[model samples]
Target: MASDMESDIALHLKADYFDFFDLSIEKIIGSGSTGDVVLAVHNTYPDINRAVKRFSLKEEDLQKRNISLERVKKLFYHEVEMVRDLDHPNIVRRSNGIVCPGYLAIAMDYCPLGTLVDHLKKMTSERIDKFFPGVVAGVEYLHSLRIVHGDIKLQNIFINADNEAVLGDFGVSFKMPENVQGVKSVGSTMGYFAPEVLKKKPSVDPFKCDSYAVGVVLRCLVKRRRPGYTSDYMEEIRSTKMEDKFRYFLERLLCRDPCKRSTMSEVQRSLIEFTPDRYTLELSRKRCLEDISNSSMPQQKKPTHKRSASSSS
Candidate 1:
């Protein structure tokens, strides 16, 4: 019965979509925004393992206007153009994609290691420091392409099996135009947003927003707590208000003025020269590995939230 169901799904999927990575639908590893499914596929006629993303255009209610179908089409085109144009090792490589009836998907390289958010939640500072360079490099590469990731939270960044950081989730990226009006409410986590975003101030810069998010992630590594939100420690950081080193870094990134924040290039330089405190790296690594191993074993599906169309840029 299971085999029959799998075969049915295979029949529905288009050949052009499946041929790029050379795998069937049954090998799906995960799914993302808008039922975007990622499959662990084989290369060279079952020689090697690769990952592919397929976009499904099934409407919840075909009787309705089917706005979801339109969104899927737009997103598919946007992702293909963006990913094809971008050439960064830290960014997931797009092998190919196909737009077929009820099925549209892209092929990408699979990363066995999971999201950085999950990894960071479990690890200490030391382990994070050792692996932080990859993140910096990835961000630098994005900047080189004149793109602002807009969303730089931990969930969008993944760690590979080799512990290298790979940036993903480019659903809200933007290239700066010379005469651009400011973006209002780009999708971003509350605790991770910069002051400019929170205040909804005009003249906000997209690059600075990315910088603020990076600072938030860095603070998570050093403090083991999400900053900007109202926690006891966060309150303490707020009260100190730029006195503490970590808080200072956060403030610098989260500065209301875009011109004040450090650029991705500067961030890369800092990560390379950084010397972490003793024993922090090993402890963080152990904790992260343990947490991920335990959590990934029995994955529970969470309710999906509707993301706002607003650009964090």
Candidate 2:
């Protein structure tokens, strides 16, 4: 599989890079220090709407950045390469990629509904039941291939045109080498990092780290906000009145010891057998309706500042 993927990437690299002139940029949907995300459509494929992510100046002045753009190129290439091989419905689909002089861009299906976080803010138990299966299936597939998704936050989980949860963003993902306990170090986001990772311990299990993040993601989905990376979050979880099925599952996922944490397969199995409690579903639905009502209200106008007459004179 590895050799086959290498050959495939080679072929893809040789293929014509997407022509920037042919793509019409609609608007800037998101931007950050790493890069900017634009909504664009290819003139040749007008019917297709894509979210194009541009990694600017990633290929310039390698020594200053410490890591060469060659390495950066591999990261994007690896993501594209992995996407090409995996055909699961829950994994975000990649359309095309271009490596121009100063930047690299990859196009993917434009998710109009937004991310999992957006949906979770007004979450319902039905939504969790509906989306959780697909997400677990996607993660299970990655684990089956020994690919550790180093980042597993809600932002990386997108809602597709079908309203299904599709996991995206493989910037921190890596294939685990056989016989290795874990990687020495890796990048992560706050609140999502496992205890071992937070402590900067040697030989941290990347896969287990993913489970820890997923546990946090699930908590956020229930609370409509990311949990603080402190004992307070755990205290809240303990005190919160939740269904036994869910509480039990979360207990396994949120265990402080990575060894005690449930594997992706175990999570998948639990989700299969477990049904969401009715009381929880009702509470979720109530919150969703409240969110709708709040959003429907008109925003009040801000008072305008008046210029002083002295300044005019």
Q: What do the candidate models score in CA lDDT, each in turn? A: 0.63, 0.73
lDDT of 2: 0.73
> Candidate 1: which stretches are off by over 4 Å?
1-16, 19-22, 25-29, 43-47, 61-67, 179-182, 225-248, 275-313
Question: Candidate 1: TM-score?
Answer: 0.70
| TM per prediction | 0.70, 0.75
lDDT per residue for candidate 1 within 1-313, as digits (tens), equals 2244233323234445556446555455656665645545455455455566666666763224344766866776666666666777777765454555566666666677777756766776556755556666777788776677888877777776677778877767876665664566554676777766777776566776777777777767765555557212344447643324455455665555667788878767654434454347767888899788668754653333113213322
Residue pairs with backbone atoms closer than 3 Å in model 1 (clashes) = 53-106, 54-105, 55-104, 124-284, 126-280, 126-281, 127-281, 186-310, 186-311, 186-312
Each candidate's clash count: 10, 0
Question: Which regions of candidate 2 fall more than 4 Å away from where they truly are?
Answer: 1-21, 43-46, 58-71, 275-313
Instruction: Give the per-residue lDDT digits (tens) of candidate 2, residues 1-313.
Output: 2255555553333323345456788788776444677888778888777887776654454554556555766766776665666668888876455555566677778888788878977887778777777777888889888888888888888888898998888777888877776888654688888877777787888888888778887788777786685522556679988766667777877888889998889998787557556557877998999689668856853233123324545
Which one wins on lDDT? 2
